[model samples]
Target: MCSLCGVLGGRGHWTDTSSHPEAFTHVEQPTRRRERQERTRLVNTVLDHYGLSLSDWAGSSYVLKTKTGQTALVENLTELWANAEQLTKHDFDPLDEALIDSLAAKAAR
Candidate 1:
């Protein structure tokens, strides 16, 4: 599917909501946007280890890109690791001890 169509028709992933879907109505739009921004920032911390980065794309999807200009539009976190590995030719393990240590060190700063 085309990127535009995918963005328009995509279903919300479980991670997209801070609370129950029904309660999402009580959240303000800016608050939702900020949540997404925070998620992107946190994801970037991991992606940086692989020499890649992610950015929020139009508040609907994520743009994952490599240092040499390769890019992919990630629809959600479910697709993030796969695309990051493909783009960087490196495996990403969320539970890898080294990654956990790096994150812990960064958090300590």
Candidate 2:
């Protein structure tokens, strides 16, 4: 039994509560592998519209090459997805308008 939650040895015992005073005791952090998978999924979905794909560049970085042979350095999948969302809202070339609209609409959902 624990003092804070009155539960047995489970989730609460894993975190160092002293470091995150404001964080809830039961709040769970996403694992690195899970985050990577999610990022890959989002990046793939966004890039697939343009017939592009994400390839690992260096550790923790990715490269998205467009059909026109232009390359975009995605520091991380989150950043890549965000840039796509922002650019699609405007008139971004190289990306088909229909695809942009479709991806943007999907993101909204």
Candidate 3:
């Protein structure tokens, strides 16, 4: 629905009651938004050319650049199982999708 009619039709990519069935919340953190766009582009480029998901190397983590142009990694530092949450579906390789699924699982616990 989303890939075809929703997003393609400019109806909505997040909400349409076809899947979510709820009013979606839109949070526009500029930093996060820019990072997300960059990550998405990186993932698509990598996947298209390399046929590999970044998660394979990242162990399902994301990296960030700080205001001072420094680098930081936001990860589950709890020392839990590398995949304890059973997050991320088997075939969902796109960075944004996998991250969302992974985060959802972590939050549920």
Candidate 4:
């Protein structure tokens, strides 16, 4: 028997469906891709409203610059949005509050 057959007890590693119950199942990559795209789109929509945008730095992190000239290194969309909402709440701007509410509602969905 070949090396693969010997290791799999005479069954082909990729061709044998009897030994591995999940040999043909492919069900996670595309869902994750769509989720990532959607998250990025929603986050960008909110950021663009405030004249802010995410700049890719390295890995899964980004740099966000606020309209007030403040900068933050946000880990992800959720963290960045949350921080923005909190930081802007000190001044009590109605438009900002409404925008944050809209972002929160969309994120919850």
**TM-score versus the correct structure, for each prediction:** 0.79, 0.43, 0.21, 0.43
Point out the worst 10-residue segment of candidate 1 by lDDT: 1-10
lDDT of 3 by residue, 5-64 (tens): 223233322412232434534463334345445654554443333232322224334443
lDDT tens digits, residue span 1-109, model 1? 2343444554466777754466466545446788899999999998887788999999877899999999999878878887787777787987899988999998999
How many Å off is the CA of 13 in candidate 3? 24
lDDT of 1 at 51: 83
Q: Write the per-residue lDDT of candidate 2 for residues 1-109, one digit (tens) a residue.
A: 3323445544322232433446745467665455556666776776776566777665345666666565666554344554454434433344678877888889898
**What's the number of clashes in each of the models?**
0, 0, 0, 0
The global C-alpha lDDT for each of the candidates, from Candidate 1 onward, is 0.79, 0.57, 0.36, 0.56
Tell me, what's the RMSD of every candidate? 3.7, 13.5, 14.9, 15.0
Give the range of the ten consecutive residues with the poorest summed lDDT in model 3: 76-85
- Number of the predicted model whose lDDT against the real structure is largest: 1
> Candidate 1 has what TM-score?
0.79
Arranged by lDDT, best first: 1, 2, 4, 3
* Higher-scoring candidate on lDDT, 2 or 3: 2
Number of the top candidate by TM-score? 1
List of clashing residue pairs for candidate 4: none
Q: Which residue pairs in model 1 clash with each other?
A: none
Per-residue lDDT of 51 in model 2? 65
